[model samples]
Target: MIRAVAFDIGETLVCDDRHWSSWADWLGVPRHTLSALVGAMVAQGRDNAEAIRLLRPGIDLAAEYEAREIAGRGERLEESDLYPDVRPALTALHDLGLRVLVAGNQTVRAAQLLRELNLPAEAIATSGEWRTAKPAPAFFARVVELSGVAPHQIVYVGDHPANDIIPAKAAGMHAALIRRGPWGYLWADDPVGAAADWRIDSLAELPALLEQHRGEAG
Candidate 1:
């Protein structure tokens, strides 16, 4: 039985792409510039410190981005109310007796993101706090341990296949890919190209999909 359901924040539960895009536009850089900065740092063998240094040009921009992101977050629910099915979908999973938690890449800002969205403070498990990011087995393992559930007993739903699906499965969890419409993890694997046990175009489809799994398990 599925005893718990873990989610990836950002693109999964709440949406922050608009804030990011606006930041990118304001900074006069490509939307993927931040992503490229991280990648360049890794490629140059500088680790996280170097990545931050490279992005120093936009230090002031960071505050503006954060302010807008936090202020505008959760203003309308999921992704500006564009995807109105999020709350209902989460409600259905909750009704199924599954423990819910969000594992996001925000590190220290994860909690802030949840708060901006008016999400319960306890629902988040962020990578920033742990000093690690997703797609790494250790990151997902931390959530499993925190949840007090075996990996196989949980379902991890995300919009990124690599960050969410592959690693979740590697940790022995069921994986589902949410078709994120332009509001996804910019630094992670593509949702469509990455492997997953199942893929759905909307959160509205999640309940029935889980029921199918329950049926099969039974």
Candidate 2:
């Protein structure tokens, strides 16, 4: 049985692409152009705003970026308001007697966002407390230890491949990828290509997906 179901917060349970789009607007660049540039900078381990500040003279772009992110908190509260179906889905999982947890790389700001969005804190398992982030085996290991579940008994779902699915799988957990966002090229948009054990587009689908593995040979 899938004893525990874990999730990633950013872009998986919460939406962040809108924040990026808002940031692009703040930078006064075409959405697609900004998206591409941001992707490149993130790929190169560079700061998108710093890169913009260096090249785009006289633009106190960092403040704009901060404003966009602050707006993301509001948006997460407004838009990511826990999809209409998410509550029922999670309730169903609870009904089935499976433990639910959130395991993700979240900044301190994100914790505030989750609160603003009214995401339940009961099941949350985060890396911020440990100063670690996903794609790091230590993060996944920490999640395992915190949840008190053996790796094979847990099912991890997230929108990022390398950060969530890949490491979870390596840690002996079944992983599912939820495709979201254009930032952090953790996985291609193509869910199948991500090679996750499973994929779903929305959190509403999670209960059924987890049920599928209850009797399967993992």
Candidate 3:
């Protein structure tokens, strides 16, 4: 039986329009230009950061991030950034007595902002804090360490199949593919996406699905 649920942040729990828009603004490009590049990268199965690199060739992203922070135009997360179903869905999981966690490829400041939102989660972590990113076995190993349960007892949910579903499954965790974001919808019908233990259109669908899992396990 699943004892815990961990969620990805971008386009899973949080809508990332503002995040990319900010980057476009910082790079002095039209928001739509950056947005189009992101979509193109997603379509090509390339890293999303490639879009930004394409905008500013040979740019050092980390240094640029520090510069943006110093300029007071760095990462910002607000309650409005969260998807409508996030609070209620997470609350329902918490009410079911499951350990709810938020872990994704985000920055330390993003983690702090998420905690400030006071979502119904036992813990919130990021790639920056762990110094690891998804699609990597070590990242999922860290996730297992954080969950404090057998990997099979935890269900990892995300909108990215390559990063979230495949790696989580390889790590022995049940994977839930959420079909919402660009990558989510674009690859929803792919065979790799079909490998997920569950495919959900919304987080609100999760509680009942987990209940069914419990019933089957019984």
Candidate 2, residues 49-144, lDDT tens digits: the string is 554654466776446546666766333345444445556666777777888777677655556556565443345655666788778889888878
**Per-residue lDDT for 35-103 in model 3, tens only?**
999999999999999999998899999999999999999999999999999999999999998999999
Regarding lDDT, does 1 or 3 come out ahead? 3
TM-scores of the models, in the order given:
0.70, 0.72, 0.99
lDDT of 1: 0.66
C-alpha displacement of 14 in model 1, angstroms?
A: 2.5
Q: What's model 2's overall lDDT?
A: 0.67
Q: What shift in Å separates residue 212 of candidate 2 from its native position after superposition? A: 3.0
Better of 1 and 2 by TM-score: 2
Q: Which window of ten consecutive residues has the lowest lDDT sum in model 2?
A: 184-193
Per-residue lDDT tens digits for candidate 1, residues 1-218, read 77788888756776555644554565567878855664465444344335344655446544654665676642222336334666677778777767877786764754554556654323677887888888788898898987788988888888766567778888999887777733233323443335677677777787788877888899
Q: Local distance difference test, per candidate? A: 0.66, 0.67, 0.95
Clashing pairs in 2: none
Whichever of 2 and 3 has more TM-score, that candidate is 3
Choose 1 or 3, whichever is better by TM-score.
3
The lowest-lDDT stretch of 10 consecutive residues in candidate 3 is: 186-195
Q: Per model, how many backbone clashes are there? A: 1, 0, 0
Looking at model 3, residue 194 earns an lDDT score of 89
